[model samples]
Target: MPKRIMFTMGDIACAEGAISAGCRYFGGYPITPATEIAEWMARRMPEVGGAYVQYEDEIASITSVIGASWTGTKAMTATSGPGVSLMMEAVGLAVMTETPLVLVNIMRGGPSTGQPTRGQQGDVMQAKWGSHGDYQIIALTPASVQEMFDETIRAFNLSERYRVPVFLLADETVGHMRERLVIPDEKDIKLEYRKLPTVDPSEYLPFKPDDDLVPPMALLGTKYQFYATGLTHDERGYPSDKEEVQIELITRLNNKILKNADKIVEVEEFMLDDAEIAVIAYGTPSRSAKRAIKDVRQEGIRAGLLRLKTVWPFPERHVVDLATKVKQIIVAEQNLGQIYYMVKAAASPTPVHLMTKPAGMPQLPQEIVQMIREVHSS
Candidate 1:
């Protein structure tokens, strides 16, 4: 296949990316900003020999994705804030089961149904803590329509490689924005599939992990008779009540991510070689910050931008390193300050300031430039 380039919106590009990544199953509910993802999947899945199901709600949507993944399908689901809220418990179930799946949260403003049409970064923290308990998650935040396409594919690959749920944390601003998207030839796009169990059915212990700490997933309808449940489980995937079982299970889940943070976390630094003030941002806000940094640079402010391409498993090392060299770090996002706290903690000893735009469009470039000047002067 040849490279295809076209203009498209972020949500639609994300759906196309999933299909390109070999996602054969999509189960999701329709919601503002993210509905295009499901709509695109519904129309395109049949053409590509895939399945698309619009569930009754987000809970059923996520539940169906988990079940489909167990069947050895590349399954995914997309929704906005309220829908994600409804799927929290099921999210926990996926984490506990170590299911490899993709979730696209096109974040809209919310504590409730705050603003369905508006975009916000309020869900940054929710993506990490919405589900109960201690488990690590892979989340990527895309700043533009092009990234929505590229990052969706990356999300699926990561989920499969790590045997964990991965999220594309987009927002209404990016999801609805139009831009040029380039689709590479299938042969050129890198893809990853979950490792399958090779042991005989009788010898199979479903959750038994390899040295990487990611277990070989057994297909649901296969000859394997391994059991799986939400309860704390051992290598055999059976529920366990013992303290050691809980510790072993939870610890491995955490270690799989913590141990590989360097490989999983990614960020983009712009014009920071000799920057005096560093601006850390992601998602829609990063777009504004980029333009703002350029504006400040023209004014001789020596500003730079640190854009997070992978939001969760927060890129602490990069932020900490930037903090040491820059005089001060300015954190910007669409939310009041969800990720700001993480940056402050990681970039401690060095001063960190925040520029927040709550439940609104991403802060404008002019506004951000003004903030840069304020931080630069003081």
Candidate 2:
């Protein structure tokens, strides 16, 4: 259980984290900024008695991962922007069927292959709504290489616990950045495995949830013969078209995450004890927010940072509370105000300004401090 110091990229650390979390199946395709994850998984999976496959495309990659997940082992996949676009249908399939899996999206600049080498968080909103229809997702944004390692492991835990697809939304900057990461001994890492069915073969239901709205998932090879489909399904996993069944099916899908918002979302507040303005950021932009706060604090200004660790379920309550305390809020993001609009909606009555830089570069601390000054002036 000795701690080991290893200097590595965020993607490499993420692959290692998945391995540590007992992920036995990695089905992925190689893509820039995220290929290292797949490469590392290929090298390490077999050594640990796990399976790794380089699929034909992103679509096939995710499709295979979803199929592997039904076998009751932890499953994962990694890709960049375009790959995420290709996996949208697969995402919906996983959601509709309530299959648990972890997807790591190492974002690059994009509407369509925008910037391959540079890191831009243009997928913030897309991650939430990319898949058609209404379903809630649990997404974690890591601010550092260390968090990239830590959060990926947590992503699998959340995905398994909720029986839903979870995302580790890392930007290209973090994915490519190399830093010293602490590789804790395997025995020290607390990992979460999905809940399994306990009922007799005659009584098993694939979509039937326990009290937590997460069902006891049974492996495909088990004695029970279960069924799953993307169509509206009842507790028995059979397709149903009746209004009452449809209502129950969709509501449970949304409620499993929305109702458990308190348990599913996490946020970190820095130096907000008595702040007049706040900087709201996550992922790479939050790094600038941290530095900006330190700079402003020395100038006799009361500024703070509200960094979101779990972005989805969007931290509405915490954001509103901080807005109530502060006179104004600044949302700094690498893209053109993807999350800024969300902050404005939640922080009503309190002015929320957008500090957006879409050139695929990280926002500088000075720029954020200047934005804070503007908030003070207005």
Give stretches of model 2 more than 4 Å off.
none
Model 1, CA-based lDDT? 0.92
For residues 1-378, could you state the per-residue lDDT of candidate 1 as single tens digits?
579998999999999999999999999988997999999999999999999998899999999999999999999999999999998888889989999999999999898998999999999899998999998999999988889989999999999999899989998899999999999999999999999988888999889889999999988888988777899999989898999999999999999988988989989999999999999999888988999999988899998999999988999999999998899999998988988999999999899998989966789999999999999999
lDDT (10s digit) by residue, model 2, range 1-378: 467889999999999889888899999998998999999999999998999999999999998989999988899999999999999899999999888899999999998988999999899888999999988888899888888888989999999889899999999988988998998887888888888888897988888888888888888888978889999888898988999988888889899998898998888899998999899999888998899899988998899999999988789999889988999899998998988888899999899999988867889999998989878888
Candidate 2: global Cα-lDDT? 0.90
Candidate 2 similarity to native, TM-score: 0.98
Prediction-by-prediction clash tally? 0, 0
Off by over 4 Å in 1: none
